[model samples]
Target: MTLAPTRIEATPERAPDMRLYESLVARVSRPARYSGGELHSVTKAWDAHEVRVALAYPDLYDLGMANLGLMILYDIVNRRDDALAERVFSPWTDLEALLREHGEPLRSLETRHAVRDFDVLGVTLQYEACYTNVLNLLDLGGIAVRTADRAPEDTIVIAGGSGALSPEPLAPFIDAFVLGEGEEVMREVVDVVRAWKRDREAGGLPRIELHRRLAGVPGVYVPSVYAVDYHEDGRVREVRPLDGAAPGRVTRRVVESLEPPLTKPIVPFMEVVHDRATIEIQRGCTQGCRFCQAGMIYRPTRERSVDEVVRAAGELLDNTGYDELSLMSLSTTDHREIVPMVNALMDAYGDRGLKISIPSTRVDSFSVEVADAVARGKKHTLTLAPEAGSQRLRNTINKLVSEENILTAAENAFSNGWTSVKMYFMVGQPTETDFDVEEIVRVASAVKQIGRQHIGGRARVRVSTSNFIPKAHTPYQWVGQADPATLRRRHQILREGCRRAGVQFTWEEPEKSLLEAVLSRGDRRVAEVIESAWRGGAKFDSWSEHHDWSVWQASFEEHGVDPAFYAYRTRDLWETLPWAHIHGGTEPSYLRGEWMKTLNEEITLDCKRDPCNVCGMQTLDGDCRHKIAELVQMKVDGDSTQKERLMQERERLMMLPVISAP
Candidate 1:
C-alpha cells in the first residue's frame, strides 16, 4: 500500500516580533516598504474574520503597489464583513538575505502575521518573469514550495492574472489557477477555502478533496488533476482530465460591464511606479492587434458610463489626495463618449488644478483632440504605440496604423503646443526584415523634423522598441521569437540610425525577451526548470541588475529541458499547444483564421464599428452583438447634428471593402 504524502503543519497566527522586524527595516534601504501603515490600508482583528486572504504580488513594493488589479481585489475582499485581505510583496534581495539569516519568515504588511498563517494566499502573476519570485515568496513564508507537500490546513495557493491564462509553467507550484477576471471568481475561491477549513476543523479533510471541489468551480483549473501526454517528437498529444470534476477546457470568466470603479485606493507610504488616482475607463480593446494577448483574452470590450467615470475620478482624488487622475484602459481613446467624458471631467475639476491623463491613445487626430482637452494646463509629452515600423509589417501584425496616421497625429500634437513626443514600436515582429526595422528610425526622424518645424529646437522625439515575444492566446502564438543575434543587430541599426538622425531611441534586452517567450509558451516540464532556477538563485529575472541568464541556462541543462523547444521552435498548426486546454474566450478556429490573414498581410475591420467579424466572443456571452447594437443605439440617440455625423461616417466606412488594409 502507498503511504500518503507527508502532511506539513500549518502555521499559527501571531504578530511578528516587532523589534526584530523594525531593526531589519531600519537596516534596509527602503524601510517604508515594510512599514505597513499606509493611509486607507485595511487591518482587522486576526480572529474576527473566518476567511483571511493574503494578496501577494511577487515583486518589489515599488512596482506592485502601483498595480490596479491587486488593489481592486484587495478592496473587494476587504469589503466583506466576514473576510479580510492583507498584502505582501516580495522582499528585496537585501531583506531576503536578512530574513533568512535571522530565520524569520515573510509576513503580511497589514497585520504582521506570517503568510503561511492565512487561509488563502492569492498571488497575482502579472508577467512571466515573476514566476521564480512566486516560489521564493512561498518558501520565505514558511510554506511548502510545491502543492503536493502542502497539508489540508496550509494556505491554499491560488494565482490569477494575464500570466495565469498560460498556467502550465507555474502549475506545479500553484494549487489552483483562477483563469480570468478575478472580480467574481475570487469570491467563489474564498468560499471553497472557507468551506474546506470548516470541514477540516470538524474532522480531518484530505487535500485532494478540496482540489476536486475547486476544479469544479467555473474559471478554476486544478493542474494536478489533469494529465498531459506527449507524442514521440515531444509535442503535447493530449491533455486529459484524471478527475470527473475538471473540465476538458477551462473557460475564462468575464465581467459583463466595468461598473462601480474602485475608489479610496490605498495611498502608498513611499513612491511607486505610477503615483496617481486611476479609473479603468474601459476593459478590452476592439482594435484587434493580432499580436496582443490582452485583446484576445479580454474579448467583447466593456466600458463604464461617462457619469460613473466622472464620479469615480472625484472620489479617487478626494480619497487619496492625488493631483493627477489617470483614465486607464487598453485603448482609452476608443471609448465612445471619450470626448464628452473628458469635457465633463474638465468642467467639474478643471478649476481645481486637476490633471486628467489618458495613458493610451490611437494614432489619429481624434486622439490629439482628447489630449488637447486634457492638456489645458501642461502638455508634458504625447505618446503613441505604432507597434511595427513599416506599413507592410504593420499589416502583417494587423496594427492597422499607417505612417500618414502617425505623422498626422504628430503634426496635430505639435501644432497644439506639445513639444516632446514618444512613439513605441516592437522590433522582431513576425515577417519583420532589416528594412522594416530601419523604418522605425526614419519615422522617428520624420516626426522629430515635424516637431522642429512647429517648436524649433525644443521639439524632441523619442522612440522605444521592445523585442517581440509571442504571447499564448494570440494569432502570433504559433510563431517563434526572433533570435538574440538578429534582435541585437536590428537594435544596433536603430541605434546608429537614430544617432545620425538626432532622434533618441531605446530598446529592451533580448535576453529577457527570450526568457519570457520560453516561460509564456512552456508546458508541464518547465515547472522543474522553474523550481531549479529558483533554487539556483533566479529571483527578480525581470530586473536588469539582478537577472543572471547563466543561472537559467544552467537550470535548463540540469533539468534536461531544452529552452529552445519552447522559445525558438515554430509550432505546427496541427500541434496541440500547452495552453490548448485553457480557452481564453477566443475560439481556436478564429485565431487560426487570423494567423492565415496575417500571413497574407490582410487586415480585419474593427468589430466595434463594422459588422461583427465573428471572432468567437459572440458565442461566449452574446456580448459582441449586444455591445455593437448598444454602441449604434447610443450614437443614434445623440443630438441630431452628432447623430447625422456618426451616420454618415458609418455609411462611408461600410462602403469600403472590409478586407482591404488602410
Candidate 2:
C-alpha cells in the first residue's frame, strides 16, 4: 500500500509569499480561521505525500477543533507517511458572505489548498441538521452536489459519524457512508485510496476503478453500487446491491480497548461549543430507553479502566491547557468505579482550579456525591434526565428511575451547595398523556420545593423538555412521532403549568423537532426532500435563526411526500424500514419484543443490573464485554411491570387531543 516514488513531488517550490495570503485574508472575515499555523498542527511539503486528505467538519473553526472524532482520524491518517491529512470547516455566515463575494473557494486550514484539490474529502456527519451545511460546503468547493455527477479527478466525498446509521437521507449527496466508529476503518480507507492513487499515477487504472475498490471496503456504502426500489406508497421496498456488489449491510466497528491515549487533541484559539478536553469514560448505554437511538446504536456499554481515564485526563489537561475536562458517556454515574474515579480526579486536580464535568448522569443519590466532589468551587448546575414526568411513563420507556429517587437526588444536589438543578423530559414519547405533561410540571414543582427546603429561597429549579423523535434501530423505530400541532399544544401545557408552579421551563421549538423526527425516521425517499430543501436556500437548520421550516415543508410538498407519514404515523411491526438491512448489532427480534413489552407496560431489566434476558447482544458475539452485571449488582429499584403500565398509559394519554378551554 506504500506510495510510489513517481507519485511524490520531484521538486519543491519556494514557499508562497505571506503578503499574498495576508492580502486575501484582509478581504475575508476571520481570516485566521483558515490559516494553518497552529502550534501542534502537522504540515509537510506538498511534494512529499502521495495522497492528500482534507478532513472537514461542517461547522465553525472553534467547534471543529474540539470534535474528538475529527481529531482521532486526523491523527491516524497523518500517522501514514504517504498521506497528509488537513482540516477545514464551514465559515460563519458573515465570513461565508465575504468569501462568496470574493469568489473564494473552501480551503484547508493546513495547506491553504482548495478542498477540491484534495485526493479525498472526508466530512463528518454528526447530525441531520448539518445536511444543508454539507451541501453548501460542497458547492463552495466547486464540486458536484450529487455523487452521480462527479468525475474520477473530483475529490472522493465520504461521510461518517452517528448520522451514518441512517445515511439514506443524504445518500445522493455523498459518494460513500462509513457506518459506526471510524477509528479502525478510516485507516483502512486511507490505505486503499493511497494504493488506488498510486496505480492511477502509474497509468495502471482509472478513477472509477478506485471508487469500485473503496466500495468493497467493509463498513463503506457506495450508493452507486446499490439500486433503491420504492413501493407505490413511497416507502422503500429494498436497497439492493448491483453488479455483483455485496448487500447494503455495513457493520459498525468497535475498538477492542481504549488504550493508546488520543493525547494530541487539537487546540483552538477561539471559544468553541465544547471548549474542553473530553475523556470517553465509556461507550454505549444499557438503560434501554425505547425512544433513544444512541442507547440502541451504541450498545453493550464499554468502559475504559478508571486508572486509564484518570491518566488520560491529567495528560490532556497538561497537553491542551484546558481549564475544564468532560467525562463523556451515556450515563457517567452508571460506571461501576465512578466514585473512585471522581475521588481520584478531585484528589489530583481539585487544587489546580480544574473543573471536571460529567455530561450525562443518572438521577441517583450517588450522582450528587460525584458532582459535589468535582464541582467544589464551581457554580454547579446538576442535570438529570428523568425522561418523563410520571413513574408510569418512565417505566414504559424503561427509564427505571422512580419519582422518589429524583426528589432525593435533587435534595442531595441542593444540600451540597448547588443552587440550581436542571431536569430533562421528552414530549411526544410513545404513550404520553395530558396528565404526564402536567406531571412534568408537578415533578419540577416537587423538586423545587425540595430544593427550597435544602438550599433556601435563592435556589432555582428548571425543567427542560425536548420533543421526542423516533429514530432507527431502536424499539420505537416502529412508532411514529407527534404532529407539530400536538407538539405545540404539549409545549404550551408544560409552559403554562411550569409558570403556574413557579418553575422555569425551557423547550425546543416544535417545528425543528418535527423536522428532526421526519429526517430521523425517513427512508431513501428523504434524499430527494433533503436535496430539495438545500436547493431552496436551506443551510444551518440546526440554528434557530437560520432554520426555515417552510422550506422543509415546501420540499416535502414539492416531492409529493407527506411528512406526517414519517413523523407522526405509528409503524406496523411487519412494515419494512429503510435501514432494516443495516444490522446495528442488536437483533430486530429483540427490539420487536421490547416494543411489545412497551405496549403491555412490561419493563425489561437492564442487563447491567439483572440476569441476561438474552436480548441478542450475546447472540451478536458474546456477553457484554464490559462484564456489566458482574461489575454492578442488579437491584430492582422499584416495581417493574406496574410502573411500565403507568408510563405507557401516560404516554397514550399525552397523544390524545385536549378540548379547548371554555
Candidate 3:
C-alpha cells in the first residue's frame, strides 16, 4: 500500500534577538566564532527543504571547523535540493554560562535556527573525551539529554565516526549510530528520516516506530532494540537484538571508490587548527600496525587518481583563495604516484607561492625526498612517528621501520636544510620494558647528534610521547593499559633523560589517557557514570584547563563503577567484548590471531604489496582486489626496481645502536 506523503507542520521557534545576542557576543572571547557569515556557507530558506540537519562537532569551533569529515558531510547534505545542513559546536565555558543566564538556546551558524527545530541532529564522535560535550550541547539546545525522554516530535539524534564502533557506552544517549564511513550512508539516513517524518505526521506514529524503521537501514545501529547480557564477572556475555528488524551483527558500510570530493569548503572567519584548503588524496591504509585502530578499521587501501587529486587541489585553492593546500590521507607518502603528484602540483602551483604539506608519512628517506620536492627549499620542522623506542618493540607493533630507517631519514632531512625534527613515540605498549622506554630518549639524543653535524647549536629535536590506550577493534583490544602510576614513572624517565641529553620532551596527561581508555572500551553500564560526570560540570575533558579529574572520580564513585575494570583488565581469549556486534570488516578471529602474533613478536606484511594476509575482508564487501591488481600491474610494468633497491639498502644498513640506560 503506497501512502501519499504528508507535509508536517513545522514547529514554531523564536529566533534569538540580534541585539541581545550581539551584546552577549561582545562580552565573550572570540565572538567571531558565533557570528557566522563565512564565505561559501549555504543558508537555504527554512520552508524550502523538507529535511533540516544540524551537523555538530562536540568541541570548540577552532578545532571542529578544521575537521574534514564534518565538512564533507556538510557539503554532501547541502548539495541536495530537498535538504539543508547547518553547523554547530560545543560552546566554551564562558559562552555556556552566558547562554544559561540569558535563557538562550544554541543556534545554528547559517540561519540562526534553534537546533531543536531541526528534523535530525547529527553529532560526530571524533574522540571519546568529547562525550560529555555531546550531552551538554543537546541540553543547551533545548533537547532532551537522554533518548528515552525524547518525544515523537523531538529531533532524532544520530552519531558516527571511529568512536561509534563501541556504541554501548553511548547507547542510552544517541538514538542511532552509523558505523564506518558515512559518505553514502548519510544520504540513506536522510531519506529514512524524511520518510519517517512523513509517516509520523500522517498517522502520529510513536518514537519507537522511527527507530524500528531506521534499524532496517544498512550501517545504522539502533541501540534501544538491542539487549546486552552480562556474565557473573561483569563481562559482556552477549548482545542480542530484541526486535527482528535489527541485524545480529552490523557490518560497516564501505564505498567502492572515493568520488565527489568537497572542492568548495566553507572558509572559517577565525583561524582554525588547520586553516588551509585540503583534499583527501586517499582513504584507508594497508600497514598492519597492531596498536593502531585506524589502520585496522579503515582497510583495503583506496586511492584517488593523481589527476583527480591535482584537479581537486586546483579547484579547492581557487574556491577558497588559500595560499596553502594539503593532500590528506592516513599515509600521505604511501600514495603510488606521490612523487609525480607532488611534482605536478609543484610545477602547476609552486610559482604561485602555494605551500604544500603532507601531514602523515613513513619514517624513511623516501618520505624525506617527497617532503623536499614539495617544500622546494623552504625547509621547516619534519614530523615522524617511530611509535616505539627499540626495534624489537617496533617489530611487535608492526611499525616495519628499522633503526637505520630512522637515522637515515633524520640525516636526509638535516642534509636537505631542515632545521628541526619532531618525533612521536608511545609508552605503555604491550611487552614494554624499562630498557625499551629508555631507548626513546637514546634515539632522540642520537638524532640530535646527527642534526648538530650539519647545523650546530641551531638544530633542534623534540620528542613527544603519548600513553598507549587499548582501543576497540584492534589487536590490543584485549591487552590491559598500564596504570597511571606506572605511566607516570615512565614519563619521569623520559623527562629526566631528555633533560640530561639536551633534548626537548613532552608527554600526554596520564589521567586523560586513563579516561580515554575507560570511555573507549566501556560498555552500556558506563553510561550512568557518563551522565553523572556531565551533571557534575564535566565538559571539554580534552582540555587540561577544563578537565577536572576529581569530578570524574566522584561520578565513578556515585555510580558504583570502577574505571579500572574497563581500562586495566585483560580479557580472556574466549570472552565476548562490548563491541563484538559492531563489525568493521575485520573479524574477531583475525584480530585474535594478530594479538597472538603480537605476543610472539611476529610481523604481518602489508597486503598492498604482498599477498593477502586474510585480515577478514575476503568474506565481506569492499575487499582489496583492486589494490592488489594495481600493485601487481605496477610490478609487471617494471616499477618494482625502486622498491627492490630500497629493500636491499635497508638490509645493508642494518646496524645495532650502542646506548646506556638513562
Candidate 4:
C-alpha cells in the first residue's frame, strides 16, 4: 500500500509573528494571497535534511500552487531523504506594504526563515509579465537584484520553465537558468548543493569553487561565463563562451516519461483559480498553433498511458478529496487513446462520484462524446477555441478549424445538456482584417442560434476575445502587435457587432495586452525597464485590479527604452531574437520556414497526423526520430478520412435554423 501523505497545518507554531508581517500585508491589495496555511501543504523538518531549497513562484500563492512544474519539482525534491523543499510566493500588495513598513524581509511559509537564508532559491519563470516581480522578490529577500553585485556567499538563484527557454531578457538578474523540465535536472542540482554544503562545513573547498562546479552541470547556463555582443542595429550578434567553458547553446532536458505529479495538491482554504485537482494527461502539443510560444517551447509531445493517468487521478482523489479532476494538456482530445483512457477512468471511479474534465478539448464534434462521457449527468459549460472568425485568416495562422465545425460542436454540446457555451477568439492575429473581425461576430451569432435551437429557452452562449501578443520562438514572433489605438477600435467594433447579434461578448483590455507584448518580446535591455516599473509602483501586472499602466509607461521612459520598438515593430526573419541563445528543440530554420508559409497563406499541416516535415525536433533528440516518425504515421492514417467526413458534416450542421424555445 502507498504511504499516506503528511499534512502540515498553518498554526502559530509554524506561522510567523503577525505583527512582523502585518505591515507588508497592508501595502498589498490581497493580504491572503501571501499567507500560507492552505490544507494539504507539505512542511518537512529542516534539521532532517542537509540542504533546503525554496521553490518560489513569482506570482501570488493561489496562482503559483496551480502550476504543474512547481508541483512536479516539489514532489521530486521532497521524495529524497537528503533534500527538503518548501514553497514561497510573492505577497500581495496589501501584505507587501505592511512588511516594508516594519522593515521585515520576505520569509518562507513553511519555516518563516528569510528567503536569503535558504541554500538555494529555485524560481519557476513561467511568463515575461512576472519579470518585475522577480526583481522585487530579490530586493525583498535582501539580495542584490543584479548578479554582479552579489557575493559568493549569497544564495544561488536559479530559474527554469518556458520563460527560461529564452533567457536573454532575464540574463542579468539570474545567476544561472535551467532550461526545460526540472524533474531530472533538479535532483542533480540538489545533490551538488548538498556536497558543497558538506565541503564548506569541513573546510574542504572554497565557496567560489563550489559555484564553478555547479556551473559545469549540463543544461545550466551561467551568465558570468558568457559575453554578449550586439550589432549596430541593436540586435544580438552572438553570445560567445568565455574561456574554455561549453558553447553558449544550452540544450533543454526532457524526461522519457512523466512521474505522477502532485499526488497531494494543496487545498486552498479560500476560493482560488483552478481549485480542483489537476492531472497532466500529457506534456507538449502536436497541433502546432503558429502564434503559440508554448507549442514551440514544449516540443516532442508525450502522453501518460491510460493506466498512469487513472492511477494519478485515484491518488489525487484519495489524498485531496477533490470532487472534479482536470485532465490537463495543450489539447486533451488529441491524445491517441483518449476514449479508452476516459473510459478506464470512468470504469474505475464513476461509481464513486468522480467526474473527469478535459480542459483543452479540440473544437470539433467528436469532443461532444468525450465531454458527455466525463460529465455524465453533470451540466457544464462547453468551450471551443476557433481562434479566428474567417477561414482565410485562420489558414494564414494555421488554425485550420472551420466556422461550420465550431457551430456543429456547439450544437452537439447544447443538445447533450450543456446549458451554456463559451467560444474563444483572438482579434489581432497576423493578416487579420476588419472582415475577419466581422466574421467573428457572424460565427458567434451562428453558434448562439445553434444553442437556442438545440437546448431551447434555458441556454445562453458567450464569446470571449483577447488581444493577440506576438511571442518569441513562434512563426508570428517577428510580427508586430496591434497598437492600443488599433486594438481599441477593433474592440469597439466587436462590442457593437456582438450587441447587434444579441450575443454576450467579453474581452481583455487592449492596453494590458499591449504591455504584455512589450514585456514578452523584450530584450536584455528591457530588464532595466522592469526594475524601473517595480520601483515606480508596479506589482501583480497580471491582475487587472493591481496593474498600473502609468507606472510601466514611466519606467519605459526612465530606462530610455521604447516599448513600441519591442511591441509594435515587425522584424525580418533573418534578424536574431533576444532569446536566440536558448534552443527550444525546434530549429530556427524550421520556424523561419513556417513564417514564410504564413506569409503565403500556406497551411503547414499538423505533424501529429502527417509525414515528418523535418521540423527539427528529431534532430534535437538525436535518436527519437523513429518514435516521431511512428506518431506522424499514426496521425496521417488515423485522421485523414475522419477529417474529410468532418468537413461535409459541418456544412450540413450549419444550415440548421436558430429559434428561441418557449
Candidate 5:
C-alpha cells in the first residue's frame, strides 16, 4: 500500500493589504503567480533569522520556480538557524502595471514582505535578454536601479549564473557578481553579508568596507572596486583591481561534488517550462566540444553514484507528489552507470506510475535503448542534438558522432514506437559554409527518410536551427560572429531546402542573436546601452511578441557604440578582452589550442574513456578518467552483486575531497 505525501500545513503571511491583493488576484492571469500558499513551501517567522535573503530570478514565476540553483540556495540558507531566504521573480507585464498603479512594492512569495526589506537580493543573470527586466524589477521594489545611486538601506543586489562570466554589461546595476557554481559559495556570500550587516548596526562598517569584505569571498566579484580603462578605440586597455582584497584575476568557484545539493526540490503550484522532480546525475562534460561554453566552463565532469541518485529520486517523488522524474545532465547518456542506473530507477518506481525523462542523448543506438526503457508508453517527444550536419563540420566542432551514428539512432527511435523526432542544429558556426547549410537539410532529410522507413506513415519531424552566438569562455570566443546578412542567407537556404522536403524548419531570428552577441562580448562601456534600451522599452526581448527591435537600434545609436565592433569584428589573440581576467576553469592557452584544432578540422575524444587532454581542470580536481574507470571496475569485480558494490562506490565517492590540487 502506498501512503500519501506528508503535507506541511501552510502558515499565514503578514499582509501588505488584503483588499489590494484581493483585487489583483481577481484581475490577474494565473493568480497563482502572486498567490503564495503552495504546499511544502518554507516560511520561517519574520524575526526568526539574523539575515534575510530574497532569491530572485529576473524572469517570470513559472520560469524562476523551475530553476534548481535558486531552489538549492533557498533550501541551504533556510536550513541555517541564522539566515532565512524567500522567493521573488519578475512580475509579468500586466501584473507589474497593476502593482505599480496601486503603489505597492514588489514582495516575496513567502512572507509578503517588500523586497527592499531583505538584506541581500541575489538575482540570477541567466540570459542577456533579461537585463531590462532587472531594472524594471528593481524600480518596482522601490529600490534604485543603479548600484551607484543605491542607499545603504536598499537591498544589496548581486548577480550570478552563466551571465556573470561576462558581467561587464550589467556591472553598473549589480552591486556584486558571483562568478561560478553557486552551491558552495552561496553560504559564504550570505555569511559575509550577515557580518557586514552586524558591523553596520555597530556603526563601524562603511560601504567601501563592505564591498572590500564581499570582494574577499571566493567567487564574489565587486565591480565597483575594480578599475576599467578603455583605449580611444573602445577596447579595454586594462581591468585592474583598485582594492588590495580583490584579486587581479577572479577565477570562478567550482563545487567539487554533487552530494551536498538539495535532494528534495521544491514543487510548484502551477505548470512550469519543466515541471518534474529532478536528480542531477552529473555535473560538467568532458566532451571538449569547441563551440560549447558549458563544456569549457564546467570542467572535469563529476557524477553522483547510482545509489545516491536512486535514493534522491524516491525521496523527491515521495515528498512532492510529482508524477514525473528527470535525470538531469549536460549529457545524460554519458553517465558511467547510466544503463544500470535507469534500470534501477525503473525497477524501483516503474510500477508506481512515475514517468522518467532524459534530455540530449548521445548520437548512438545505446542512448536510444536508454530512452526506450525509460519512456514507458512512448508518451513523450524524442529530442536529438546533432548540432551540425556534415561530418567535416562535426569534426571541426569536435562533435565526434558520425552521420551513420545519427541515422542509426533515428532508426532505433522509430522502430521502438517514437512517432515524432526533433533534431537540433546550429547555423553560423565557425568555418561554416553554404555547403554546410545544405548538409543540414540533407541530414534532416536522411533522418526523416529513416523514420518513415521504420514508422510507415507516422513519421513527424521538427528540425530547429539556431544562430551561433559566441560566448565568453568557449574556444570560439575570439572568433567573429556571422553577420546578420550571412545568417539571413543561411536561413533562406535552409527554408528553401526544408520547404521542398515538406519538413518543419524553425530558425532563430538574427536580431536576437545580434543583441545576445553584443551583450556577451561587450565591456563596461556597454552598460549605458543596456540602460538606454531598457528605458526605451526593451523588456522581454527574448519573447517574440514583446521584442522591440527598433528600440535596441535606437539604444545603440544613442550610446554611439557600433554593434559590429563587439559582435562582427574578429578579435586578435593578444587583445585585452573584457572577461580576460575572469577565469572559467579552463585556461586561455588551452582554449586557443582547441581553436587551432578546430581550424584544422581535428576531433577530440571524450576524456572519460581516453587519456586526459590536460585542459587545466586537472589542477582543480583529479582526472575524471579515474572516476568512470573505478565504477566500471567495481561493477565487474563484484560480479553483479550490485548492492554491495553500489554501497562501496557511493561511500568512496562521498569520501573524495570536494576540491583538490593535482
Candidate 6:
C-alpha cells in the first residue's frame, strides 16, 4: 500500500533547544544536516501518537540517509497512525563537539525532539565500525550506553541489521536485537510499546515485565533474558532461555514474497552516498560462497517478477522525480529474467533520460550483455567483484567464476563502450598464498591489455583489495582471519605487482581488517572492549582520518581478552560458536559440509539451473523458486535419507555435531 504524507508537529515539551541548535548550525561543515526541512519529510503531532521512534543510523548524515534498510524501516514505522518515526544520524565531528560544548542532547530531524524523548530508539547496526558510534549516539542523546544502567525513563535501545546476526559483541549495550527483516517485527515492537505506554500511564509497569513482554516477540532477542556460559578455553559453552517463554534459538524472520521491494524511498536534500532510486529486485543469493555471510544468512532466494519490477520502477520514477535507478540484489545478474527486465526498463525510460545501474554483477559475459542492454554502451566504467585473484583460490572460497570468465567479461565490456574496469579483490581468504596474491596483478594486467586492444590506450585497470574477515553464519565462521603481518605482506605483494604491471592499485589498512575481525566474531566479553574504545575517543572508525588503532589496542588490553583469540584462533568442529543460538535458515551441519567442500576443492552447482542441492531454504518456506520452476525435479544436498534424518534431528540437537573440521 502507498502511504500518504502527514505533517507531524512538535509539542512544546518535544521541541529541541533552539538556542543550542541555532548556535551550532552555523559552525558545522554541513549546516543543512542540522536543519529539519526535506522533501517528503513526515511529521505528526507528537502527543497524538502512542509511540515515537527516533530511528538512528549510527553513521554520518550523508551515509545514513543512503541506507536502504534505514529508509525501509523509517517508512514502515511512520506508516502506522499510532506510531511515528523520525530520522537521526550521528552528527559529524564538528557538530558532535559543539553539542557537547553546549550541553544539548541529540535530536531528531522531523519533530526536533530530544532523542531521549522518543519511546523507542531503533539503531541500525549495518557495520562493526558502527559499534562505537552506537555508544556515541547513546551517550550524546542523553541515554546510558549500557542496558543495565539505563533507567526506565530512558528510551528503549534496540538494534537490527546484518551486524546483529552475531550480536554478542554489542549484547551488553542494546536492550534487544531484531534477528532479521524488520518489516513485521518493528511494527510488532511498536504495538507492544503502545500497549505498555497505556499500562504505564495508568500506573507503573515494571521495566523487567516490559522486557519480558518483548521477549515473547518472534525474532526479538533480549540478551538479558538469555544466559551465556563460556568455557575455560574462551569459547561459548551454552545459551539457555530464562523463562522458557523465549526460545533457546531465535529463527530469523524472512519475507516469502518480495512483491514490491521498497521502491519509493525518501529523497535527501544534499548529496548522499548513493543518490538514486533503488529497487531490490531479488532478496537472497544461491552462489554459496563459503566466506559470504550475506549469502548464508539470507537464503531461499526470492525474485520479484519482471512486470512487478517495471511497475515499481515506473512508480518510483513518477513519485520521487529521480533520474537514476539501480537494481539491487545479492547477485543482480543471476536473477532469472535479468536481461529482459533491463531491456524493458531501458525501452521504457530511454526517452526520459534515465540512468540504469546494476550492482553485484557476476564475472561473466552475460553480465556484460545485461550492462550493455541497460546502459546502451553509454556507461564508461564497469565494476566486477572477482573476490579472489586466482581461479583455484576462487574455487576454494566457492567463488564459482573462473579467470577465463573474468577476462571474457572485461573483453565483452571493452568491446561495448566501457573504457575502465574496476575490480574488487580480497587477500586474506581461508586458503590464500603469495602466488594467489601475485595472480591478482596478472588478471588486472590481462584485463588492461584487453581494454587496450579494444579501446586503444584509453584503457584503465584499477584494482582495490581488502582483507576478508570471517563472519557468523558463514561457512568460514570456524576459521580465523589472517594476522597483521600476513595481511600486510599480502597487500604489499599485490601493491608491488600492480605497480610493476602499470595497474592502479588501492588497498585498505591492515589494522582495519584486524579490528573488523575482532568486532565480527567477538562474544559478550568483547562488549567492554567496544565501550572502552569509544570512551577512549574512537568514532567514525571507518574513516581513515578518524581511525585510532591505539584506542582499540588499549581496549583489548584493558579487557584482558586477546584480540587474537577471537580473530586468529581456529576453532574445533565441536566447539560452541558464539552465535550458535542465532539460526539463519540453514543447519550448522549443512554449514559444516559447505566448509568441508571448500577444503576438498569441491563445488556445488547453482540450484537455479542444476538440481536443488538443498541448502535448507526448502525447509524454511518452500523449494528455492517454486512459482517459476515447479516440476519439483530437485535434489537435496546430501544423501536423501541422511538429509531427512538430519532435518528430523535438527530440532532435538541444539549444537549439531560437526561432521568434519577443516
lDDT of 6: 0.82
lDDT of 3 by residue, 541-603 (tens): 999899999999999999889999999999887789999888888888989988987777767
Give candidate 2's whole-model lDDT: 0.78
Which residue window of length 10 is worst by lDDT in model 5?
653-662
Each candidate: how many clashes? 0, 13, 0, 18, 0, 3
List, residue by residue over 1-662, the lDDT tens digit for candidate 1.
12222111233344847568768878988889987868778777678789999999999999998899999999899888778899999999899999999988898888788889998999999999999999999999989999999998898999999998999998889999999898989888888888888898998989999999999999999999999999988899998999999999999988876649988788887888888889998988868899899888887878899999988888777777787899999999999999999999988887777888888988888899999998895896999998887878887887767788899999999988998999999999889999999989888999999999999999989999999999998988999999999999999999999999889999999988999999999999999999999999999999998899999999999988888899889999778999999989888888899999888877776777654667777757667867546556655675465446545553443322235321
**Candidate 3 TM-score versus the reference:** 0.93
**Which runs in model 1 stand beyond 4 Å of their true positions?**
1-18, 625-662
Model 3 residue 184 distance off true place after TM-score fit, in angstroms: 0.8
Q: What lDDT does the true structure give each of the candidates?
A: 0.86, 0.78, 0.87, 0.77, 0.82, 0.82
Ranking of candidates on lDDT, top first: 3, 1, 6, 5, 2, 4
lDDT of 4 by residue, 1-662 (tens): 24354555333244345455645554566556666656656676666677888889999887887887887787778778887777888877656666677788888876666788778899988877788888888888777888877765677789988888767668788988888778888999998888878777777565456646666787777776777788987777877777365556777777766766667777766677788889888888757789888888776778789988888788888887786889899889989889999899889888788878888878888888888888887877988888889887777777767676787788889888998888888988888888899999988888878877876666777779988999887888889998878778888888999998778899998778888887787777887888778888787788788889899888888878888888889998888777776677778898898888777766655556544556677866533587567656657577556556544443443422211110
Q: Give a tens-digit lDDT track for model 6, residues 10-68.
A: 54244735666767878889777767657667776787877899999999888988788
Off by over 4 Å in 5: 1-22, 622-662
Candidate 2 has a TM-score of 0.90
**lDDT, residue 360, candidate 2:** 84
Better of 2 and 5 by TM-score: 5
Q: Estimate each model's TM-score.
A: 0.93, 0.90, 0.93, 0.90, 0.92, 0.92
Comparison by lDDT, 1 against 2, better one: 1
lDDT of 3 at 251: 88
Model 2 lDDT tens row, 107-171? 77776777888888899987788888999999887789998788766798999887888878887
